[model samples]
Target: MNGTLINYFFHCKRQCYLHAHKLKTEHTSDLVKLGKYYHKEFEEKDEDKKMINGVKIDKIEGDYLIEYKKSNSDVKASEYQLLFYLWKLKQAGIIKTGKLKFKDNRDDKEVNLTLEKEKELEMIIQKIKTLINSDQIPPVINKRKCRKCAYFEFCYS
Candidate 1:
């Protein structure tokens, strides 16, 4: 139910479900570490980080809730993660647009929490809860992208 969960839910359902079940492996991931280093290195301001509902947002500046990524490897995932933050903001009676900032300098993607997207998010949340509770483990995706995932060893080995 955190932003990473939302991102992983889109990136790989198995990773998301495993994370919910506390089968964490990201700490051992070099890619993950690199992203963290990149994030800390580029953070605009310490005060911009915000915490709400137990999730840490990267930054909130003006009308944009900005999310930073090391790369645009998964744009959809990044966008949805930002959207989840926007939804959280809405719940707190704060509405703002979302911006995705890639350390690789890819063009930013602006996300708006339209009514349609809000409904989609509701469904995604329900699906995430269901996936987390289900006893069945999701099958390995076995894609090239899986090679870069923190759960790659757990899934492929």
Candidate 2:
């Protein structure tokens, strides 16, 4: 139920399941390398990176939880990831808005967890649990975006 799991659930169910089972392939991905680089650079600045339970938050200012992404290619996945973080914080009695920052662009998006969205997120979380706990792997998407995924080779070749 971590943020990465939430993000992967939206990005690809197979990826989420594999990751939960510790079949990590991120180190073999250039895109993943770039993302790690961005996070490392941010961490080097000694900026805000605080962990609440199992979720790692990038930044927090006033009433906002800021998330940094290496690219804007998958904003939807990122948004849901941030929403999961917000939901986690709320469980700890901390409610805040979510802000997304992309290193590849200047387009920043804000996310708020409304009652409707919260309900949706809760349902998503349950679905993710069921998906990752199963003995089966989801079918490969086989889309163009799949070629760029860290699990591309593992899924295709």
Candidate 3:
């Protein structure tokens, strides 16, 4: 799974399901466009297509996998997304720690994929598979975050 799927899994199950099924709406979101711009600015010169099991890693600096984000509004989700990349790298026999860099906040958070965390990520991947295979979309949670979500209109309108 990609980082977007992992991010959507933590943010909204409905979004996870919709995105897995190819019902994308991020293109129309101004927030998404802005995020893309920030990501481009932080992107490394090489390693743009650093794909591991279909997940595109932002950058690889020696033994660290670097992920740059626009904000820390959903730090937990972002953490998991970084961990997911680390896990994929480990599976490919390239173990590496993760560094989450928030450009807007000017902060960096480290993420290490431990044995326990790797187990947890495996479980999460299984859960994601189950969610995507199911026919029903998850119900709207109506959280405040929905207002800024790219899939807001698809879910509410």
Candidate 4:
């Protein structure tokens, strides 16, 4: 889970560990609830989260790797996450471009990541791995990322 998408999820390291290890979070936030709702709405009727070459792809449509985003404004992180998914999809022989956007709104304001972006995301994944191995929770003093973070309680505590 040290991929692009996971890297953007930077509120708490312990939570990241649980997610990376595929452990479910006992408590979820309203945002998580909204995402689940959106996924149910937009994902293909048969789509289920899949791990392809160690990458967790939310869904795939033809030659597109689809990853839903639920961000208030910072959409770049979501784009990077989708790039990470595409990078993994490439490894799984599902090479394709990726699109990241709000699932519920469908406002057409999307962050599209190119193959180059995927490479950039690959570099970022390395950095994230190093940071995680060091066992440090990068400060979110401004709390912008923390506000909507699902593990806010754990992070604040």
TM-score of each: 0.94, 0.94, 0.92, 0.70
Candidate 4 structure quality by residue, lDDT tens digits, 40-154: 6666564566778887666666656767655536565565666666666666777676766575466644445566776677677776677656655555455566667676775
lDDT assessment of candidate 1 = 0.89
Q: Record all residue pairs in model 4 with backbone atoms less than 3 Å apart, i.e. clashing.
A: none
Model 2 segments beyond 4 Å from truth? none
Q: Tens digits of per-residue lDDT for model 3 on 1-157?
A: 7878898899899999999999888899999999999898888465544677666878888888889999999998999999988888888888998999998886889999999998998899899999999989999999999999999998888
Backbone clashes counted, model 2: 0
Clashing pairs in 1: none
Candidate 1 lDDT over residue span 1-157, tens digit each: 7888899999999999999999989899999999999999867555768687665778888998888899998999999999999999898888899999998987988999999999999999999999999999999987899988888898878
lDDT of 2: 0.88
**Overall local distance difference test of candidate 3:** 0.88
Worst 10 residues of 3 by lDDT: 44-53
